[model samples]
Target: MTSLSVLNSALLVLSVALVLLHVSATRAKPNKARTLFAIFCGSIAFLMCKQLSAASIGPYQFLIGIGASATCNAYWLFSRVFFRRRDAIKPQHLYVAVAIALLVAMNQIYMFLKGMAVFTPAPDALVRYILVELTLLLSSCILVLTFWEGCRGFGKDTFEGKAQRILFLSVFVFALAGSKIAKGLLADNPQALEYIISAITLLVMVSTQILLMWRYTNHLDFLTTIPLRERLQPSAATDATKATDSRGELSPLARQIRDLIIGQAQYLQENLKVSDIARELDAPEYLISKAIRTELGAANFNQYVNTLRIAHAQTLLADPDHLKTSILAIGLDSGFASVGPFTRAFKTKTGLTPSEYRQNLQAK
Candidate 1:
């Protein structure tokens, strides 16, 4: 095999392993973000395998195009799941991905039936133009979403935040590099550039996997690059096996969680994330999330954290000594990022703006 094919084969092997590992690992479960990430990674593996066997299997350019489309859809879905809580990979998401793949396939299927061969340029081919434009459009959207997630998550100190930054970097590199590769293929110039792009892709993927493991291990504090399945997964002995009755009654775990947040006031930490709390309790992030949502009456992690902040602010406002404190100061002290978000959250919880709530407090 050529050196390029050898490289492709190596990457293909690694990507396949990643897919299998991600799928079988129970620890990553109950986390839709991780599942979508696996899908994203798996799509990369498919493309790599296709490239590694391109000589024998033919370019299968249309199938490759479908894989590209699937990657885009997976990235978009992962982005949504990463940033939003309680959200999931909706059926429509799968439908859209399937639809895109079918559309691309149909274009090629028609050409093949008409006696057109693969990798032969039909400069005026409407199918080719349409596919190229679609690729560019998806690249643009992915770039936008990556940047959006990056900016919003900048300065986050939690594990999930670190993962977000890693994701942003990977996607940014992918989009930047993928755009160039798209252009090269679309123009059919410098075929060697495709090989180079594939190499770059290999590096990016490997580095991302390294970073993910590094961050996760560091956050968990005993994990090396490879953690034991039990250490990572924690099995059903955790919250997954807990009965509804066990959760409903303020269980010891639930009470300890409550005291940690309410009594110790961990919510005041501005950079707190569910994963951070999970590490603190030595429990799965989802377990902590479930406890807070089911037993503690939180709609989600953010809502739970924000409610605590607002409640703390209310307590501070009601203190006679703190009436002299400005609402902004109270908001900041309450762990809100700024006055605007604080005011909005305050109103959301109390049905009155900060200033109005303070005035009513004064009147009382």
Candidate 2:
């Protein structure tokens, strides 16, 4: 086998190994993120196998080609599941992915038939051109959407979460997109140059896998999702207390955070951010985040802040004096940017809508 083939084979093995690792981890933790990540890894393996079988024509090659065509879709779905705080992969997501895969597969089959002289058409045939262009257009759109997903709510993410997002966008998204564009531009280049490009792309993939493994082992929270309520429950509080002392006193930094947000009511400031609190306290953002996680039993800075905001809103919602106050007014006074997120966060925390909570309070 040629050197490019050998490298492709090695990458295929590594990609399959990653799939197995994610699968095993999912079995242990029952995480949707890990399962979707495993699917993404499986798609990468299929792409490598498709490249390895480029010279062969058979049913296996056709199936590999179809799987390879779904790589962008798989990555997009994985990104949505991983980075979006509340979004999950719905049935429509799968339907769209499958539809795109079928379109790309049909385009590939058309090209294969034309190459075999089974059908002849003009080089500029409208039908063939449209199919090819549509395939590329959809793939490009999906890649852009994936990048957007990684960037959504970036400012609110913890420091480690931000780093993981940057790593994924840089290594996986940019590398793969750049390689595809370069391959198209250099289609007529020397075979050796193509092999060199392939080698670099595979090396980037290896780097991505290594970084992901490191993050998985050392910072698993960045890769997994835990419910906000679970993070804030009494059990988590007990664990945090145990980490500190028998007295269950808050750490010094945690005390300062509480003093500012609770005592000073800084959470009443709209668009409150960890960086703003860090600046106020003259501390680093990561340190502030760590204090909240370890001492306050919050999943992140936003959750901690939202918990405070919701609690404050609950007081207003339960007060007969504030009965004249609209829910929007109360949400604004409680520091929410708008009523939508305020309502959502309130519901997640209190298990009732703001209106429902108020109605229940009045009924009591």
What lDDT does candidate 1 reach at residue 140? 65
lDDT of 2 by residue, 117-217 (tens): 76688763887888888878988888888889878866544345567778777776567666777778777764644565556546644554554454444
- Runs of candidate 2 exceeding 4 Å displacement: 1-26, 56-60, 112-118, 121-125, 172-181, 184-190, 196-217, 220-364
lDDT score of residue 151 within candidate 2 = 84
TM-score list, all predictions:
0.50, 0.54
Candidate 2 residue 150 Cα shift, in angstroms, is: 1.9
Ten contiguous residues minimizing lDDT sum, candidate 2: 220-229
- Expressed as tens digits, the lDDT of each residue in 67-157 for candidate 1 is 5345656666765554432223568766765665565556555444433453455654776678657756755665566556556634432
The 10 consecutive residues of candidate 1 with the worst lDDT sum are: 223-232
TM-score of 2: 0.54
